[model samples]
Target: MAAPEPATATATSSPRPSMRWRVVDIVIASVLGVAGGLVFVLWNLAYNPVTAPLEAFLPGLQALFHGVWLFPGVLVALIVRKPGAALYGEIVAASASVLISGTEWGPLTLLSGLVQGLGAELVLAILLYKAWGLVPAIVAGAGAGVGMVVLDLIVWYPGAAVEFAMIYAVSGILSGAVFAGLGSWLIMRGLARTGALSRFAAGRELGSRAES
Candidate 1:
């Protein structure tokens, strides 16, 4: 028989999972979103107090905490491993936040969620949704951070000084990479260790390690 094309062989050997969302996927994703939204509520209450020092030290530095909002998308995508998982998780989370305590951004938070989710979604889509590693997590977080700053500049920081905007962008991106990326990866690892993710590929990866 003739040899298979390289692309065909590669795909056969390393197939990606289904992009379809199953019931379990929806349940777990919604749970994560609600949990993240609860955290968002607390963060909203604390944002002013927590970031007051940062702003005082340097304007736009308060954005250092923006990662808290970005993690839901990354976390959901990491766990669900499905197309649109990031966007669904983020929108659900933002909706939960809005329904619970009402953010200053009001309904606009939904728009923010859409933008941030798309940021992470685009990166995963580019990779064909095959990568689930630290590097990809960090890159996804950075993408979401960039989306955040772009939206904020238009809505929240309109007419902000060039220096302040620049600082905000840097701080936001750094925070997203470190916190959302690293934090979500760690959380997944922890869940895998506990066997909480046995149904998911993330958990199965660790399961083999434990068995070995």
Candidate 2:
């Protein structure tokens, strides 16, 4: 029998992801979106009741929930590293929430999701689709936070006090950093540890470090 050719070793040995979209990726993204949406729904349901006192006392605390919806979108973008990943995940989540529980905002919720997702998406895009460091992730979260606030203030809280608005905005940015940025980073790290994301950039970076 002819001898089989020996595999050549190179400085880098990461395999290319298949050109076609993997079922696992789609399934994971979908599941994450749905789960994130469920969280948004629950949060929204509980928000008014939970924050009513705060809203009455402070007048802008209720807007914090706006940025909560951006977490899953950022997570999906960081994991998928594909164009529209953030937008799709965010839109799916918002749509799911709206479908499950009707909102007076009507179609504007979808628009907010689109803008907020784009905010995070642009940050990842500026990173040249390469680095997924904590700084960039946090920046993406902040961007989404700012985007949501801009939309909400203009549409819903136009008459809110400047101090209230500032507090609301800051709270949203903080939430985005904690929930979307830190939380998503942790999830990615966990996924990398499990070897499930071995095909993505985040996985490769963590994998290389683990090997070393």
**TM-score for all predictions?**
0.91, 0.80
- Candidate 1, residues 81-171, lDDT tens digits: the string is 9989888888888889998986677679999999988888888899889999989989888888888889999999999999999999999
Candidate 2 off by > 4 Å: 1-25, 64-66, 104-106
- Give each model's whole-structure lDDT: 0.89, 0.78
Point to the candidate with the largest TM-score.
1
TM-score of 1: 0.91
Q: Number of backbone collisions per candidate, in order?
A: 0, 0
**lDDT for each residue of candidate 2 in 106-196, tens digit (9 for 90 to 100):** 4997898888888788888787766678888888888788778888788878888889889899888777777787778888889889988
Supply the global lDDT for candidate 2. Answer: 0.78
Candidate 1 wrong stretches, greater than 4 Å:
1-16
